[model samples]
Target chain A: MTGGSELPIASNADVVLVRQQVRSAALEVGLSLVDQTKVVTAASELARNALVYGGGGMARVEIVENGPRKGLKLVFSDEGPGIADVEQALTDGWTTGGGLGLGLSGSRRLVDEFDLVSAPSKGTTVTVTKWAR
Target chain B: MERVPILKLGDILIISIQIDLEDQSVLALQEDLAEAVVAHSARGVIIDITAVEIVDSFIGRMLATIAAMSRMLDAQTVVVGMRPAVAITLVELGLSLGGVRTALNLEKGVALLDHVRGATP
Candidate 1:
């Protein structure tokens, strides 16, 4: 299994490049196109959130084997203002801005496993995983 | 992607969304939908999402926004043909697509729009 990391670019447009890199990495690690798309979408959302909400962050993509199955993991970390209310933030329809508030919650639903860690005035980290079927 | 025609049947304007309604695509269509509603003075708008496999929050919010905007223009909006998996995911994500009407199929959506327009007229 290979581990890779991408530094967050200050521009929102860089999120697309980051998404492509993560998708390519997922393919290199043997994920199917459908699975690759899902992982890529989740990564894109997180990366966009990092740029748009977190002020900027890095995304780390890693491949791991769990027994007989192999899976891809993406970790997005940012050093911006963390979520104040994690639960409310996860709730659908609740948004700090005019956004649809689907970024974190929707991305979580797209993956097999999702985890988030954030603190006020500190930073936030989001991890998402998808296993090959 | 094939561009589906904006079909008009009486007072209803049916626009088939042929791709994933996410990111900039959704944003672009918001203007188009508004224009369609105004140009035709449509009584109802049916947005077909059968080809879409995913519905992110951004798109969901756009749908809600479009629905609200359509209503303000005297047109009702109905979202149709959402896949079951996609529907479940949207629900799980807690996406509140409030104010947007939904139907299981395009035929049903058109029928519902007909009924809505009939009642209003």
Candidate 2:
């Protein structure tokens, strides 16, 4: 996986920008429309979490090649008051906000590979990959 | 603050989200819609999202909330013109958007609003 550019997540507007970058990455790797939408949506959700929950962070994208197959990877990191319970946060119906609590688990479902790490006061980083079929 | 316009079509209020919406803009739309519904005495509402490519959980929740708000005011709501890709994304995002009504286009959406209002108590 070759790392690409990084995008900062500040406000809601940057969320749109993140989606744009994610969409372009998916297209650059020649993902189908449905696949493109999935990655873009997942990026949007995770980006929002970085801003709303993590108190703002940045996202990096990359193109990964594996001997005749290609994939897209997104890494989101934030240094804020970290999550106390990772498992509960990833639950489908768990949210500290007014949302339906589908952000973490939903994004995890969209990507082929998912990784999340957090500490009480340190921060959190989420990485996901979606491979082209 | 950038605001999406709400058009009054007889007894219905039509809101078209034609651009990428920020959090502020989405909130503004919600407030404006509530005011327009009351001002025009609208009986139905149609939100056109054909131009919307990505509806994250935030926007999806906004839509569902707006539908519920409009419903409490006795106005039927119908969402129209969701692209297939967006639909898949919404589903994958895990939001059912169950309380809202949807149609293929504005024409059918308006008709649905009328039909729903017509048969309601």
Candidate 3:
């Protein structure tokens, strides 16, 4: 992993900002156009999830490398009511908030790696990565 | 904070989104489009998203909402000019956008609305 920037995810505008930043970072990492779009879209979903469900959080976007392959990594952490059931939460169309329930599952589909860590009263942290093909 | 502009043409209401939209702006665009449909008594709504680079679940839901809302308002809505990458990302994200109609470009979108409107009555 190399240099990256930390951004806030406390408002609606922050979500947009997160997407833009991720897009630039993805581009910098030499991801293809479709890969860049996927990562940016995933970042947007996770950032909004942090804001709406997690009651706001922080996003750390980084450029990562494994061997010669480069990728983009995003970590979103929020100090809100953490999710208890990770399995059920990752299920499609399952939402605690009135959303379409695609945020977690869909974001997982868009990226190469997905990790979720949270517990009751412990806050939530989601880390995702998408590598260039 | 920025509002997307909605233009009227004959019986069609056209909205070409040119900015990277925030959540609030997406909601505002939906509200504005609904109002424009009513005010103009438009029979068709063409939303040109050629410039939009991403269509995450939130924006995807907003598009579907606009389509459903326009239908109730007696207008047919068509989303146009989605980038190929955006489309792939949306599908992978598991958003089918079931009820929304899409076209290749603004002109085709207008034609689709015209065809639907003409065939209906």
* Strongest candidate by DockQ: 3
Best-to-worst TM-score order: 3, 2, 1
| Candidate 2 C-alpha lDDT tens digits along B47-94 | 999998788888898999899999898898999999999898788778
Report lDDT (CA) for all predictions.
0.77, 0.90, 0.93
* Order of the predicted models by lDDT, top scorer first: 3, 2, 1
Given candidate 3, what's the lDDT at residue B51?
Answer: 95
Ranking by DockQ: 3, 2, 1
TM-score of 3: 0.98
After superposing candidate 1, which stretches have Cα over 4 Å from the reference? A4-44, A83-94, A109-112, A119-122, B1-10, B20-22, B96-98
Query: How many clashing residue pairs are found in candidate 2?
Result: 0
Cand. 2 TM to true fold: 0.96
Residue B11 of model 2, lDDT score:
92
Best by TM-score: 3
Q: Which ten contiguous residues of candidate 2 chain B have the minimum total lDDT?
A: B112-121
Per-residue C-alpha lDDT of model 3 across residues B8-54, encoded as one tens digit per residue = 99989999999999989999999988999999999999989999999
Candidate 1 CAPRI level:
acceptable
lDDT of 2 at B21: 85
Candidate 3: chain B TM-score equals: 0.98
Q: Which structure is stronger by DockQ: 1 or 2?
A: 2
TM-score of every candidate: 0.74, 0.96, 0.98
Q: After superposing candidate 3, which stretches have Cα over 4 Å from the reference?
A: none
RMSD of each: 4.2, 1.3, 0.8
